[model samples]
Target: MHWITTTHIAVTWMLVGLIWVVQILVYPQFSRVAARDFPEYHFAHCFRIALIVVPQMFVEAATAVWLLHEGIRATPFLISAGLILVVWLSTAVFQAPTHIRLMRKFDASLIHHVTLTNWIRTLAWTARGFLVSFALS
Candidate 1:
């Protein structure tokens, strides 16, 4: 059981890491290119990303709790969870409104801001991934 739990934790951490890399490195470049060369596809791509993100967050939260309950240490897990909470708060407070406004205005400036602010989320997830890996080890 412990091995199974550890495996799940490690896999979930890897998933989070992959998501962050895609969000930070790949998605921005894709967005920029799409906006430049395929304006019509930009909004759809953004919408798809948003749709995927919402469910992934729920999965991450659930898995984090499971790992913690399965004997992952409190300090690192809680710290990582706290960081995740902060990222969500920042998204709600800063990024969501920007996205909403961008959806309304279709302004490139708003997109840039949203992408830039996304770094907060990326960093938080990356930190969480590291913590999980460490805790599992």
Candidate 2:
């Protein structure tokens, strides 16, 4: 049971790290390319990310609650999970609409805005990875 909890924590952190890398390094490059030649596809890609993000936000929140209930007493992990929830909520509330508008308008400027907004998520997820790792240790 302890091993399972530890594994879950580790896996969560790994996922967070993977997501951060994708957002910070991979997605930005893709965004730049999309802005230049494939604006429509870029807009579509943003929408696709939103589709994944929305559900992921809920899942993370639920997982956090479950971890707490299961007696994970790492303050850093709990706090980080809480922060991630807040960030995800902000993304859903603030960024999602902006992305929707950008998707409709298909403007280069909007793509830049989207890319800038994604920085928050990238950093937040990276922080989450660190926090989770600390908790597991």
Candidate 3:
């Protein structure tokens, strides 16, 4: 396996684990925050998470595209790339706007929307982890 593939797998699994943590632990706790504190907390969460995830996401995307450029046209590679697109589209189309709304005020509906739509990323990244790992094998 090439080093690019190894890097891709490592990053994908890292995202997979992080997304699950967000899904299971972080997002669920949003409602638990005191209403007065929710905006500050949500702002901090958005800022801090962006600092961590945005760079990793860019790296993951670049690596995936690099793999394709390197002539890896196998089914696993294509599927993994497609899944990455799904995650991005889900984030842009659903999650990010919902987070912006939550930032202004803690709307329970938006919270639910974010949590519900985030499954798109969580599942996509999880499947990506499997696809890359299987490609490694």
Instruction: Name the TM-score of candidate 2.
Output: 0.70
In candidate 1, position 31 carries an lDDT of 44
Candidate 1 whole-model C-alpha lDDT, 0 to 1:
0.67
> What TM-score fits each model?
0.71, 0.70, 0.97
For model 3, what is the error of residue 78's alpha carbon versus the real structure, in angstroms, after optimal superposition?
Answer: 0.4
User: For all the candidates, what are their Cα RMSDs to the real structure?
Assistant: 3.4, 3.3, 0.8
lDDT, candidate 3, 1-137, per-residue tens: 78888889898898999999999999999999988889999999999999989999999999998988998888987999999999999999999999988888888888889999999999999999999888765
Superior by lDDT: candidate 1 or candidate 3: 3
Q: Which of the two candidates, 2 or 3, achieves a greater TM-score against the reference?
A: 3
List candidate 1 segments past 4 Å from native: 1-15, 18-42, 69-71
In model 3, which runs have C-alpha deviations exceeding 4 angstroms?
none
Using TM-score, rank the candidates from best to worst: 3, 1, 2
- Lowest lDDT 10-residue stretch of candidate 1: 30-39
Over 1-137, each residue of candidate 2 has an lDDT whose tens digit, in order, gives: 46655655655665576567656675556545633455576566766765765565556666777778888777897778677766776677766777677655556576567667767776777677678767766
Candidate 3: worst-modelled 10 consecutive residues by lDDT? 128-137
Candidate 2: stretches off by over 4 Å? 1-11, 25-39, 47-56
Full-model lDDT, candidate 2: 0.66
